[model samples]
Target: MKNITYYLKATFSWFVLPFIVLVLASAAPVKNDVSEKEVIRLGFIPLTDCAPIIMAKELGLFEKYGVNVEVTKEASWANVRDKILTGELDGAHCLFSMPFSVYTGIGGKAGSEMKVAMILNNNGQAITLSKDFCGKVGFKQTGKVASVVAAKLKADKEVTFAMTFPGGTHDVWLRYWLAAANVSQKTAKIITIPPPQMVANMKVGNMDGYCVGEPWNGVAVKQGIGFTEISTQDIWKHHPEKALVVNKKFSETRREDLKNVMKAVLEACKWLDNRANRKRAAEIIGKLPYVNAPADVIEARLMGDYNLGCDQGIEIYRDNYMLFHRNGETNLPRKSHAIWFMAQYMRFDYLKEAPDYNAIADKLILQDLYKEVATSMKIKIPEDDMKPFVIDLDKAKFDPNAPADYLKQVNSINQ
Candidate 1:
């Protein structure tokens, strides 16, 4: 009797298991018509702008949109780009210029193609120097750039500066600052270090200065290793930084899923940008596996309370810091921004020759997708949002339509 009962139970369990799974699956909400079983794998650097991904996961936005999302922390921008190219990453919190570089076959890809879905953050990066140097330069409030560079140049010692990637915003900011001080990068040595390593490297004398994104800059100052020399936003207010990037293949094959992910991220950005929630967001981000730094260190910057760590002291409210949802600024993959990066690439000789500017901008930047996601969520989309915001870094007006010519003009200013 016992043997017969066991056999009957085994047979019944097999029949019921599929039915239960089918019923559970039927109850799941489907967005974008993609099945619940589909999973999205994304990559991000340990920077603050990646808050959207973490916030989206925390708020159940990914689940709401039928995306079983797996967020991975990539070591560097190069790793992020490689993973996207090989389809190892469905998407990434990548540098804004990365897709443009890939599309132009500039840095990593010889012929590989990629695209950016949206701009993630604007202006949460800083150029910081070792504290010893800060004291040596007799840091000044008015003559900030000249005083530091002049003191260092008089010493006739080589100053080693580090940046996050070859053509990234950190690098551009560093170079621009150096040029402003009449310090030729051709004479100075610049190295690529990961963002998280900037502070530690400075402490060990591996680098004299670095240009990196948030938390790390704060980390350096907090640890008493370095002082914030210049915030990148001060150089070019509301500068473009990271983005939602993926291979052109994934963007095409998983178009619906991709759109859904963007929608969820836009919602996350809205939540993160809320003024009342800034403190809570800082606390959340400072925990393990995220920034893992002090809450106060992360808090002040996110809320726009900045300290230079020099005797120059603090900036109470700087409006130029990262604004994920201010007037939906983060969503627009603006053409002018791409043109700026293209010019940077040309200025740095990252490109062997000039690229087809208009075609590359259109192919890489998908403002249409951003608009669709924003409109669906009832977020106000700006009509002239994509208009040009030129930087006088090289003392020239950048033309979005003729980016190559703009590049040449900017380059000529320096020469």
Candidate 2:
């Protein structure tokens, strides 16, 4: 019996113990292996969609994933751009079109670069028409703009509009809406204003209409200063709005850290997409230092509840409000979108000549990095990235393969 017991103990120690150790190792959380205790400084502008980055910090998602993130609130996109270029910021919740716009010279020096690591969210911006055009142009009324603007022109009103930046998403959306409405770009003076200041500028009668991201547009409507002529989703459903843009140095040197940070934000994006968590997100982001807006106002649009002012009533966008992660679809930054934005520059005369579209996209969007992060998280990537896409307002088909032909098909102001 002693001999048999000794034999059994020896076999168990050699085989079963090793098996248990291997099983335990396999079940443990895989370390992402980023260097210890390095704080990743990120930036953001005060907008509702800026939630993912801010929430990553609030929910300890960043820390959970073994990263430290400091999300600074920036004043304007231009300031965001300058800090990014200077490396004062490692990354930011940026405009999806910003790196493209900046690289192509609407607001940046030619040949300078900022890498779009991943997209943050989609479908939350809007073009808000001031109280002056309240009765003239109602919600989703893209057709009435021309006639109303024509009347304004004939009356010597010097029709003007505002966008958040020169070649950002707001500018392109505002331009697309203008062209689609047959309200020629030459007809109105389109100017740039910071997002938070948009309502105040319009309140003093500074502009007739403006295009900007949510919370501010929500603020405008809430204050009776403006009404949403069209939500950007009305312009293009699930259109890319903001991104996780990083400086070139960060992308090249701290690739693993960047991926971990992307993972953290992606987790936060998924959490925000849960629907039940949105009001909690709104309340957190509405605090004085973040968006600094009323939590109720922020929560309304955050939940797709738009109480459009100027007595235009309310618009409830259930599925298409502001998507963070639709099963990891929103995080992939497409080169095709980069190309389309550059082409829009051609259409609106922001570019005098056609840019090397593919080359420019290759320079800006960081798809390979995004794939690495999404794949590790077991998120399936969408395959329709390079395929043709159509906007909600027009029948124009944007073929990524033939951007030039699509350019010609869309009647350009320059043409």
Candidate 3:
């Protein structure tokens, strides 16, 4: 019996000892796949949609996909655009209007061709009026109140409105909303202010109103400096806001790197969209290295819960609340999006000459690259690259290829 017990103990020890050694070996430090590759520098403004870029770094999504990514916080959209254009960044979390503006050369010099790898998000922007204007207009959350404010503004002195940049999502949405309410962009003094500084500017009464991404709008409402007059979703539901922008040069030369970056971003977007992961995401983002806002502030819109604090706060739920990956829908570079932006540019007279509109769009929007990355990740791609979309301001129907035809239909003043 003693011999049998000794033999059993020896056998158990042999198996357990080998298994423990194997486990310890597996627990040894993982050599990051990213370390083998050239670092891909990504630029982003501190907007909520920048989640994907941030997540790619924080969650090791880029490393998982075998790419080294460094995210740099940009001060302004113009700086983000210039960096990507000049190769200061390999790519960026960029404005949706940027690719179109660069393609049409509306905001910058003519023929400044840039490419959009993917649409990062849609409709996380809102137009906030200073508290002074809210009190004057008696802006309320419910009823047909916005029109009343619009009428009052029309009758009274022109109010100064603010947008982050010309030909950016904020400018486009603000213009579209103002036009819908019969308020011309010209009627109000629309000036540029960096989004991060919007709330502070409002506090000082430097601007009467401003359109910007979260948590700035939330910041305004929280501070009682301003009220959210209209969410961009009111202008066009799920309207595209920002995209992954790259210079034409980068797109042409470093095709593989671009594709890899998009793939990692797509994964990050998926991770951000999962409802179960959102609170965790907000907490992660709240860390100083990222947006640095209170987790609740970022989490509010991120969870698609909004308080349009005006006369009082109203709860609004939108599925399009700054989506990164609604089954990867936002990641597609649809031609209709380009067409929509073109119509806005024409409405604002940014596109003086039509430069082979479709040709330029095709060159800049790499739908094919998006397709490859989406497929690799097993995400579905919608059949049509271009879909018919209408802007509410003038009931304008934007055709992807024939933007000039769409432009002709608009009776609004064009410069």
Query: For each candidate, what is the lDDT?
Result: 0.78, 0.86, 0.76
Clashing pairs in 2: none
Highest lDDT against the true fold, candidate: 2
What TM-score fits each model? 0.86, 0.89, 0.87
Which of the numbered candidates is closest to the native, going by highest TM-score?
A: 2
Which model, 1 or 3, shows the larger TM-score?
A: 3
* Per-residue C-alpha lDDT of model 2 across residues 127-205, encoded as one tens digit per residue: 8887777677664544443445523533657777888888999999988877876666776788889899999999998
Q: How close is candidate 1 to the true structure, as a TM-score?
A: 0.86
- The reply for model 2, stretches above 4 Å from the true place, is 1-36, 139-147, 150-154
As for candidate 3, its clashing pairs are: 96-242
Cα lDDT, model 3, residue 10: 93
Instruction: Assess the local accuracy of residue 3 in candidate 2 as a C-alpha lDDT between 0 and 100.
Output: 100
TM-score of 3: 0.87
Instruction: Tell me the alpha-carbon RMSD of every candidate.
Output: 6.0, 5.3, 5.1
Per-residue lDDT for 1-415 in model 1, tens only?
9999998888778887778889999999755433456678999888888888878877888877777788888888889888999999999898888777766666576557768898778888888888876655522356456435523643566778899877777887888787677665676678999887888888899878888989998888788888888777777767778889887888888888898899888888888788788788888877887777788988889988887786668866557777887778667888777777887777766776777767678878888888888888888886654455556343456667667666555533223
Question: What's the true lDDT of residue 186 in model 1?
Answer: 70
**Would you list the rank order by TM-score, best first?**
2, 3, 1
Candidate 2 has its poorest 10 consecutive residues by lDDT at 142-151
* Rank by lDDT (best first): 2, 1, 3
Which scores greater on lDDT, model 1 or model 2? Answer: 2
